[model samples]
Target: MNIEWFLVLSALLFTVGLIGVIVRRNPVVILLCLELMLSAGALALLAFSRMLGNQDGQVFVLIVLVVAACEVVVGLGLVVAMYRRRLPLDVDEMKELKG
Candidate 1:
């Protein structure tokens, strides 16, 4: 379809993810929102790649997928550790990771 349609969809997906990240308190929810944002970025990349008839976009999408998978693994491990320690799933508490 039209490139504009693809970009609009991607923008909408990113917006929803941004809202989720801002409005949700739970760490898991935040991670999922971040995933959504990543997915949107990948989608846009693929769409543009297809529009331009290049293989590079598809390669970038594959890299994004690997990164997203790694992100989920690390993010879920942290969340599970927090739960095991009887901590609330609050994303704000993650500030302790700053050090």
Candidate 2:
């Protein structure tokens, strides 16, 4: 029931997501990690909003969700396109997009 508990949970989620993003090489996995991070952020925002008793945090979370959705759509589209082209899915080897 305390805000600290929610904050701790959010921190844990964010840490896990950060580790996943750093340790994984697959593009899909990276995207998933990104989503996890975003969710963590949203959770923290909602928790704070609840603590403060306001609608602003809820509205921001909604916006974050929409942005996350758009990011997933574009990210997955790129991954699919890369797959179709028979390109390597490893993030380390993705040098063609450097331009």
Candidate 3:
């Protein structure tokens, strides 16, 4: 596997995820996009690790996965809380926290 191709693929995924995060209005959609970005990052890291025969990249990917898991748990909790408060999933509808 050519390292440059892996890098390019990762860049493309990251760009798409960025667009999703910026263009979407729903909180859930943003979270899913964020996950996509993270996955692309992890894939790039894994590729580099394999190419270089280093364990550090894989370790970093593992750490990222753990963090992403935590984010999902907390993010879903927030979504549930929002629904309980009669809040729409749309980001523009959230105004209770504003001072």
Candidate 4:
């Protein structure tokens, strides 16, 4: 629909994701929040691109998607590796690196 609507929706989702990132103690939830933030960013980019009838926004959105994908892969890999080695996924419980 309208660019404003898209932007507002994206802002709301991004805010929610930010809150999740800050309040959640689970690594998986943090990663999910990161994904949500990325999706909101992509949506905003696409909406602007459509409003302006330009390809730059689309290109940016594509790049953002690719980066998000890579982030998800790496983040999940790290989480799994940590779980295997640390025996737990709680952020507060991670004290191995505090030494």
Enumerate residue pairs that collide in model 2. none
lDDT of 2 by residue, 9-99 (tens): 9999999999999999998999999999999999999999999999999999999999999999999999999999999999999887997
Model 4 TM-score is 0.90
List TM-score per model, in order.
0.92, 0.98, 0.92, 0.90
Local distance difference test, per candidate? 0.91, 0.96, 0.92, 0.91
Better of 1 and 3 by lDDT: 3
Worst 10 residues of 4 by lDDT: 90-99
- Writing each residue's lDDT as its tens digit, candidate 3 over 1-99 gives 698899899999999999999999988889999999999999899889999999999999999999999998999899999999888888888888579
Q: After best superposition, candidate 4 residue 49: deviation in angstroms?
A: 1.1
Native-to-model Cα distance after best TM-score fit, residue 68 in candidate 3, in Å: 0.3
User: Which regions of candidate 4 are displaced past 4 Å?
Assistant: none
Pairs clashing in candidate 3? none
- Candidate 3 displacement at residue 18 in angstroms: 0.3
The true-versus-predicted C-alpha distance at residue 80 of model 3, in Å, is 1.0
Cα lDDT of model 4 by residue, 1-99, tens digit: 568999999999999999999999998999999999999989988998899899999999889999999999998998989978856788898877586
TM-score-wise, the better of 1 and 4 is: 1
Residue pairs clashing in model 1 are: none
In angstroms, how far off is 48's CA in candidate 1?
0.8
